[model samples]
Target: MSFDYDLFVIGGGSGGVRAARLAAAEAGARVGLAEEYRMGGTCVIRGCVPKKLMVFASGYSGAFEDARAYGWGVQAGGFDWDIFKGKLEAELTRLEGIYTANLKKAGVEIHAARATLSDAHRVKLSTGEEFTAKHILVATGGRPFVPEFPGHELAITSNEMFKLDQLPKRLLIVGGGFIACEFACIMNGLGVEVTQFYRGAQVLRGFDDEARGHVADLMRDRGVNLHVGTDVISMEKTAEGIAVKSSTGHDASYDAVMYATGRVPNSDGLGLEEAGVRLGRRGEVIVDAYSQTSVPSIYAVGDVTDRINLTPVAIREGAAFVETVFHGRPTSPDHELVASAVFTQPELGAVGLTEEQAREREPIEVYSAAFRPMQTLFAGRDDRVLMKLIVSQATRKVLGCHIVADHAGELIQLAAVAIKMGATKEDFDRTVAVHPTMAEELVTMKSPTRTA
Candidate 1:
């Protein structure tokens, strides 16, 4: 049966947009995309791009202090949220324009409203238009999930962080995940009296224990009031700002309460179940290796699938989907050996298996080091860096690489290349160290700290 378009993309995120573009431009197929909100989706519009910009803006405060230690005259002013926000919004607009232009250039129709599946092959948009396609790509992505609780409406998510009219004098960030830790450090650096309450033994619970501990220590040393084993019991608006009661027997008033506990897939009301497409308990679209859904004519990618959820990973999935369905290449996304970085005050970067995961499978040798970097030491700060290598003892191959330091994100990208190629401990030992560099630690650390 002939359809209105060859492919219908249900989202305008990196994944959906890329899939739509590739299907239309490269494969010479007609495509239509619908995005209820902005064109760039979470990563470009509200997630990584803006958050990284805030991270950079916040780091300037520390750089100013370091400048003084290096004998350079330094005077740092109070952070002007208005100016920064204006520029941030402009940059986001610029990125949105680029995405729009790319889609238009690729001959993909853009719909400015929400689209839901009418059936396996038909989609109805919010504007009452209906279209049928041979293939439907669902990449609707995810949203910050703030659980319902007392005075929950008073609390904001990371999505509203960039839109604040004014910087809060005191900000209460709840949760122990990467988003919580990142904003805790960010707000603190921006001169907000930041208090972080994580209702767990430690923050960044899923990361390497040693690495997270070091990061938490640095966050505290840098003036973030890090409190673990605590949670906000209730909150109400007061004259000061927001009054908060915590499970840890504490009371406080804050200008704002932000929850970064987690995110849920954007699958609700997408007509997936009605159309006979299966979803996970978390409302994530369940898909096969090639991102094909239960309904062969439909597919989902990116955070909607609850897979890798990274922007680059989504793009890869989208491209792979195009290859599989449109070009008949049957390409599957490579989800292994993927490196990622958390943009907290001392970034955490890792690739491959964690020591805990490796030890569970087989014998592993863990090489770990924590040292005060030369720059922070010169500044008379208590800052320290961590580098750990989890190696398979039997095969002598590096199973994991973890780094917690400034630019850990940048460093890990290069380290990930070696790990992806199945580089062994001997390969690292063979490489000459670049002197006067923190990255040299990745290559020079020879002995195992422990074997598990």
Candidate 2:
């Protein structure tokens, strides 16, 4: 067909980059990727990298205060917002360069412009260049969705939160998802007067309820004004900063109001309508099980597909798409039992089904163990760890495992492997406990809290 490239991928985020690189290298297929903005996409530049840096920076503030209990320091520790911002920018610039170099190493052509699909097999860049390919992959990912409320323009999304010139003295974060809660903890720990407003009765609405409650308590203890069951109607700029007017008629002023409410698929401006790609109600690109859109030659991956939006999951989907499409290998991503972690203070990590999801299928059993960790015991801190196992009644298989602790992320990875391998409640009990570790609580638990 004399195609310019074997595969033309739009969006150089996690999925797009992985797909293009692997398709070029392994499939020996010519690949071209177009990105109008930063090469690394949401995770590397704004979402994960910068957020984690802020988390680390905020931890130091808490660490300095916690050090008093350990008899470590006498003098005060101070932080300069300018210094932190400069460091974050330097690291992000380095990451963008690495992403570009990776594409070059993989023999993939990179186009620094937005790509709009002219047809299922053809894409046109904003530069007025047209390229035809055997297949087109859409991996534009998603962006923070700020609702259209009065004075919403005055509110900042998570995207701008990282690049702010000055650190907010007082912050009002709206919503209760991972984005909202995570930011609240980070900023509050850094000594900001942080207030969180969520319309729902609880924060982290989709996660396990116990995990959400525990995290909520931690946020409260850390001095975050957690206001659940309230919605902000509008925001107005005050002489001081920004004033948030709640739907309940409660109003408050803060230096900045961050709408960490949610994110929408970046399916806009891609000319999908003309190309005949069906999108979901939330604007997510609808794809088949093998990552194919309605049109066979077009594929969509990453957040654009509205599947698991985690970066690792997107990378896996992208790699699988290339293998199935070009290499003729019938492959699909196994999304089940995929472990993930939320980087709030005292981190939350989980894999497989939640206790609620497990109960829906059959008569299930849940085992839990909650106690003060050794580190907290030594410091006389009241913080406790939560570990739970959700077992299938029919097969006695462990369907889900969740952990809330300091090293929950690292600990849950092993649990994820176990769940993926179909490990049961008996298996966890049979495993010997690793002594002097917080993770040991997961296996040493003996009783079932509830049997459904």
Candidate 3:
């Protein structure tokens, strides 16, 4: 049966865009995509790109101190939020342009408006336009979730955090997740009086236990007023600032408060249910292994599907979807052994199971090392880095690798390649160590720290 297009993608996010581009450019199929907001979605627009730049800007303060310790006579200056924000906005605009250009070049029709399913193979856009397609794809992604409470409207999420006119002198961050921890470190480094509140006993709840503890210690050492096992009871605006009352019986005032509690899939009001598509309890699109929804003609990917939630994973899922439906390859995006990084002060890079998870599954051996790197040692800083490997005893394969240090993100990417290839402890052992490197410890450790 002929339709307006071969595919109509509901969201122009990383996943949707990739699928549209591939379907049109490679598969010779007519494709169209619509996005309610910006083209680059969360990562390029408000999430990873901008946040990583801020992380870099914030690190210079410590770099200047270390330079002074190295006899470079460096004088640190206060951070200028306005200048950085201006440049950041421009960068996002440039990136959005690239996304649009790429889609156009690939011959995908782009609609800069909201699109929702009218039927299994039909889509209606907010622009008062309707179209029918052979298949539909949803990749609307997710948004930061803020819990309801007193004065909640006054608090901002990560979306608004990027667009703040000025940095707060005393910023109160709420949550125990990576977003909360990363911002706490970023604001502290930029010289903001940063305070963090997490109701949990510790931050980074799902990560390796020892690594999370190490990060908490270093964050406190760097002057973040982190309060675990605590939460905001209420908040109110006053002439002075935001007055906050906490569960721990502490009352304080802050210039601003930010919430990074969690994120929810953007699957609401999309006409999915009305169109006969199933949604999970969290309002996530229910899809099969190949990202096909219960309705055969409808499919979903990325955060909207609530699977693996990372940008790269979404792009992979999109590509796999195209191969499965358009190219007749029947591909399913691999979700196992996927590496991830938390961009906290001392970043955490991890691939595969955590120590807690590995031990529960099988007998395992854990190799761990923590030490002050040479650069920080010369600066007379008490900071330390951690390297840990979780190995299975039965098959002697590496079950997990976790690193806590500067550039842990970079280190983990290369390590993930090895781990993804099913590298064993002996395989790592036979490799020569990169001398005077923190990562060398990954290979040089002769014995397990402890076996479980």
Residue pairs with colliding backbones in model 2 are none
Q: Quote the lDDT for 333 in model 2.
A: 85
lDDT of 2 at 273: 70
Tens digit of per-residue lDDT, candidate 1, span 277-391: 9999999999999999999999999999998879999999999999999999999999999999999989999898888889999999999999999889999888889999999
lDDT by residue (1-452, candidate 3, tens digit) is 77999999988888988999999999989999999899989999889999999999999999998898999976766788999999999999999999999999999999989998889999999999999999999999999998898989889988888899898999999999998999999999999999999999999988999899999999999999999999998899999899999999767999999999999999989999999999999999999999999999999999999989899999999999999999999999999999999998889999989999999999999999999999899999999999999999999899999999999999999999999999999999999999899999999988999999
Between which residue pairs do clashes occur in model 1?
none
Off by over 4 Å in 3: none
Model 3 has a clash total of 0
Clashing pairs in 3: none
lDDT of 2 by residue, 307-363 (tens): 998999999999899889988997898787789888888889988888777778888
Question: RMSD of each candidate?
Answer: 0.8, 1.2, 0.8
lDDT of each: 0.93, 0.89, 0.93
Residue 235: error of model 3 in Å?
A: 0.7
TM-score of each: 0.99, 0.98, 0.99
Model 2 CA deviation exceeding 4 Å by range = none
Two-way lDDT contest, 1 vs 2, winner: 1
